[model samples]
Target: MLKVQEIREIIKLVDQSSINEFTYETNGTKVSMKKAAENVVVQSQPVVQVEKEVTAVQPTQATAQPVQQEVKETVEPTAKESTVNFDHEITSPMVGTFYAAPNPESDPYVSVGSKVNKDTVVCIVEAMKLFNEIEAEVSGKIVEILVENGELVEYGQPLFRVKTK
Candidate 1:
């Protein structure tokens, strides 16, 4: 059984951090705590210390690492929020050679500052023997086109940046 104060501290850690799991151990006691997934699970495990002739709480070699692990795990949120940007990521759906124009002499499909509709052809990506016309899925203004013409592109590579209106 855990004290009320311990439960409150765990709740606070979960709310404040992006950490998905935490574990603490000292001597004979080990506590494993994790956040709820899909807002439906709250589970806690507390290990009871067995008291015998020796009453001192002496940590064994196995339990020594948990304290450091907990601290590292808890600080993950602040680090992640500072680094990741989820906005306006345009990723390739297939592997191909990115072509700005349909043919060598033809004009390019669209460039920066181009206003695109859902059916607008953004660029041409050649896969195998077929020249596939890639369309704009979102109706937006093109902020930037990331890939160069005649460049080989892998799956999920960003080719353009369109600002959603």
Candidate 2:
């Protein structure tokens, strides 16, 4: 697997070049990158066996190097108002792309402070071209969203923190 810094460098080079698509393969690791609108999209496929980890990094052209901090895993909200104490956490049942809203033009199904019931569809996880609606098993208010839109999420990872009252 390529280091985060290496990936950022590739993204920078691609953005500067006129070519629309760039592919890099080395040591059984293949990474394909493309530019869409103002966003740099990267996809990786590792043929070597390694620990399972899914990371979604959004590269911005403001600087030569993309900020590595943006590549993060599930993060718990640190703000006091968004903090939850042993509250219900909605986890991903399977690995897929996390979509907060049904479509790009529509509002998200749920956001911070949004009220939800057991059957409410909080988000959709798309795997293998199939969109799966992930429901909130416990009814409560959504305190925080752990993943960004279009980010790849892993199985059993926390997607949202629900504050059950």
Candidate 2 achieves a global lDDT of 0.77
Evaluated at residue 154, the lDDT of candidate 1 is 53
Give the Cα lDDT of each candidate.
Answer: 0.64, 0.77
Best candidate per lDDT, number?
Answer: 2
> Residues 66-112, candidate 2, lDDT per residue (tens digit)?
53443234433322354455389999998667899999999999999
TM-score of each: 0.47, 0.52
TM-score of candidate 2 on Cα atoms, chains taken together? 0.52
lDDT of 1 by residue, 8-119 (tens): 6555544444445555443334455566763323455434433334234556887853322211112112111223222364667876667899898998999878888888
Relative to the true structure, candidate 2 has a C-alpha RMSD (angstroms) of: 16.4
**Candidate 1 residue pairs in backbone clash:** none
Instruction: Name the best candidate (by TM-score).
Output: 2
Show model 2 residue runs off by greater than 4 Å: 1-82
- RMSD of every candidate to native, in Å, equals 18.6, 16.4
